[model samples]
Target chain A: MKHSHKKWVTLVFALSIVLMLGACKKKVAPPPPPPPPPPAAPTASLTANPSTIQKGQSTTLTWETQNATDVSIDGIGSVQPNGSQSVSPADSTTYHLVAKGAGGNQEATARVTVTQPPPPPPPQPTASEEDLFNQNVKDIYFDYDKYDVRADQQAALQADAAFLKQHPNTKVTIEGHCDERGSTEYNLALGDNRANAVKNALVQDGIAADSIKTISYGKEKPFCTEHNEQCWQQNRRAHFVYQK
Target chain B: MKRLLSVVISVFVFSVILCAQQDWIRTGTGLGVEKVRVAVPDFKLNNATPQNTALQKTFDDTLFYDLEHAGIFDMVSKSFMPTQVPGMPSDVNLAQWSSPPPSAAMLAFGNLGATGNNLAVQGWLYDLKNTANPQVLGKQYTDAATPEGARSIAHKFADEIIFRLGGGISGIAETKIVFVSSRSGHKEIWQMDYDGANQHQLTHLGSYALSPRISPDGSRVAFSGMTKNGWEILMYSQDLGRLVHFPHFGGTNLSPAWSPDGTHLAFSSSRTGDPEIYVTDSDGTGLKRLTSFAGPDVAPVWNPKTGGQIAWAERSQVTHLPQICIMGADGTNQQHVTDEGFAVSPSWSPNGQFLAFSWMRRFGPGEPGAQDIYVMDITTHTWAQLTHGEGRNDFPSWSPDSRHLVFQSSRSGQEEIWTMLADGTQQQQLTTSGSNYEPNWSWK
Candidate 1:
């Protein structure tokens, strides 16, 4: 009877060891609800198709993103979403995409290289208005609804200052701005703020304050959308004017 | 202002002579005088043009576009011409250049000043139709120390030629635009001449700032910005980066306007529930409320033409529909102008006879909430639509002369500033790139 009992204890102990081995095989908490599918990473992308853009040429950018209910572009000027974008990139142009899709967020990118507009078409006997107009246009942008000189605008501002410096005889008028989200009065003030922001910046960059003037149109102008920051973003900015 | 005027005159002269007339015009197209043809003398490289250089393209293109954009004269195509009009019409391309063919009438020429270093362009427009050799215009100037300035030189030259052609220089070639950017992730102002030359940034800080207004006096600016708390009216000195904010953080302050005297700041705020117009000292003192409304109101412009009359917009009933209103500086004689869909951003003309407001076309094809700019004759009470485009446009400010209104537009799917005649005629885009909105004309 003692021999039998000892045998039984050995058998129980062996069974316990087997169970411990199974437990140590893998660590995890009952597979944890499959982790709600990773918040879908807010599908985002920027594209510059016709990849090679000229210094002053327009290119089309197509951004396709899904899942995100909201989105915005970080440094590049105002852009609207779609399958195509007609962009004249003077500098490195990027299109920031923010979107939402069913599975989650997905992102994509398109690069654009403006390979210097074809040498003004060999100085045609007669020039095209687009060429001059493109050169005349100085693209700019602002933050949310504010019109202050953002740090990003420094390059363009300094370039403008340099132009003013060289021209010395040239005078430019600064126009302030605001997106379409605020009241007219508020936007006007914001526009003034934007214009003044530019004037202050230009003057500080060594352009004479007397040489630069300003104007404000509060939320009166919208470049892209009727409702989203995509469009409102364009509405907020400062512009300049130089006399003939 | 005097300095600006002198510069204008100089640039006008400098641009006319330097900017080359295109082949149609250089070759002579759009001459109105079908029989009138102009010759582009081969451009001589007073400074040699580098092969396949961006500057060369930029310089050559600058001259071509400036002349064509003027729309006053016709130009011949380069390919159509026997040889490239190398420099200016004065260069005399004895081989390919001719008169009386295609009814040529005038001659224009100029030179690219120097190479590697900044270039100076000089050109002249002559009416060949007149035996007197009518030397109509001439201009010369310096560009950026490098090839970059070639565009500016071209622009200046174009402006002069346009003036000579009697097209009235309002288009490219002479105008500078200022706006904001966040390439550095923070808001700051920037500016560039009429031609896209020399881009730079101003104000390098981590804080988010906004609303930059240039004073008619061209000495200072006013805007709404944050200083710790929320938003407030900040007056910035164009000469000194002096950000003077009102003593208190006004409720999300924005829409800053300068009184004709440049001593007062007319702005819009909601410190009292609904947004109301208010006036304050340029230094941020003497706060005075100017409007009372249950609904949102904003865009205050002190009329330089109307003798201190304050113009703005207010919502009398429903939030969606805003009515245009005007009152005195003291908030007297309150008057309502419209009972339409939605109206906001009231800008008074320098002459004060008109007020330009941003009007939204309630039902449109492209989108539901598309906006437009409108001009109201104070005496007639009739409204005129200034811009008609695919996308939305708002923020309309009239030129000092009141003949033109500058506004923001999203016609090309990008927000940009544009100018249109008060009659809504010549709608030209001011800002070509970037997202820019809210344009205010300067009395200066």
Candidate 2:
């Protein structure tokens, strides 16, 4: 009887151990829900199609962003996460894109270069300096309320001067403009200065001083009507028109 | 017997016209003091002729507007006046005029008429407080019977009344304001009476023109227009009835300001590769540069009283802000007059003791500022801001008498010309339709 009782006790202890091990294996601690994913760092990428173009042409910028709540570009304003825009920068320009997300922020960049095209057909006698400019040179851009020739714009002005020299009879008028930021009276004066700055550059590059005339439309005339830095940069420019 | 009776009536009218006195009395002259309560009833038409009735209506309206704009008067509205209008001094009841509702302290009554090519006006002012000597002023005016002559007669009488009652300052009742209007589908120079009547287009160049500046003698209007050859300074001679030759010396020439003597013209020109303040003979010869800074300098106005200094907008090198700067007529003694923010369009007061300009205290993008009118006492460099967070207010031009200023404001959606007393009271809009800007008050 004592042996039978001892056997029953040993059997019960083994069964209990097996039950406990099975319960522990089935639970497996649930893995802590994978740590909630850490919110996700935003990513942004921007690309310019036909990044190089002739003076009068334009380029398109396309962008794609991931995990972002807001997106904006350096010169352009607020934009959708995945969108595209067309821009006509007078000179080579670097555009920056920023993406903001719940986790962190990310940035990307793209560039567009304005390239000179081949010369036009043989210049006709009646062709004015304005005609020549329209056919060959691109307009010069400026910073807000500025008239000094930036270092990056020196090459274009040099090219314009060379073209003027190539056609000695041409008489060009530089129409200066503002970005619609200052008083009209002051903008008129600032536009006058911008045109003169381009004229000075042309004169320095061997163009005749008398060949250049200046006019200031101030903030009246604009090439791009969008209210953004990218567009305002295009409006603040010195456009060349040849005399008829 | 009929002829004798008519002769007696004629003698009576002539005697009243001849015997009236212009004795002026002052009540007070303190700034912001209580405005003199004055009532202006419609002038009675003498003889009841159709021409005389029409002239009387026009004259009465003109006189009322001028007195109301004087800023020293609390004008009693016509609707609040008694049913009886006193057309002569004898018809006036002092107690009625001084009664409440209007509670007028003074009254202006008149009789006016127009005969064959002639207009005659007899005007009188009475002070209710002085029952014994209530006649504060009396005047008689005679001119051509044309509509213009009627308005002129009223203006002259109103000026006389204001000069007598307004602490020795001359009135601007006869002044004119020339401004740019786009009402004709294109921007053109238009001139109007100071109270916004008689608005007539002065230029038919059929293109955009701006900044009309009348000469001190009112002979010509110098403005910048977009001609076929581009923007050039053109002069429309009021005397010649055609455009006179002002040199178009190439490059953008704009903002022509006449010197006090009308012998020299100051303008902004970029003919020298940069915009510089250039002063030339009135016809645009003998060019000399007045500003030699790196940035542009523009909008030059002469100190009409001194005629020795010119004030202008010069872009500051340190702050990149446009500041009001004053220099000698010979381009010497250059000094900065503004401290911060964007400042432009400096117009010197007629007395040369003050300068009125447009200033933006927080001028920039994404964070814009309010452009307001400010008058600075040149002697102390202290300023008083005249406008607050409304629309942009700019281009203040002083009246010939220096008692009022006409300017451009965008408060009514589109830009329009407005006027106010020199102390910044009595603000009245002078233009309603289309965009009008850059008002230049005539020298008168």
Query: Over the stretch B126-244, how does candidate 1's per-residue lDDT look in tens digits?
Result: 66555554567765676664655766666666666655554243444544444444445655555544333455654554554455566777666565555444456665565776554
DockQ of 2: 0.39
Per-candidate TM equals 0.52, 0.72
Candidate 2: segments with Cα more than 4 A from true spot: A1-136, A151-171, A208-211, A224-231, A242-244, B1-32, B47-54, B115-117, B144-147, B227-230
TM-score of structure candidate 1: 0.52
How do the candidates score on chain B by TM-score?
0.71, 0.87
- The top-ranked prediction according to TM-score is 2
Candidate 1, residue A174: lDDT: 62
RMSD values, in order shown:
32.0, 23.3
Candidate 1 chain A, which ten residues in sequence have the lowest lDDT sum? A127-136
lDDT at B48 for candidate 2?
A: 93
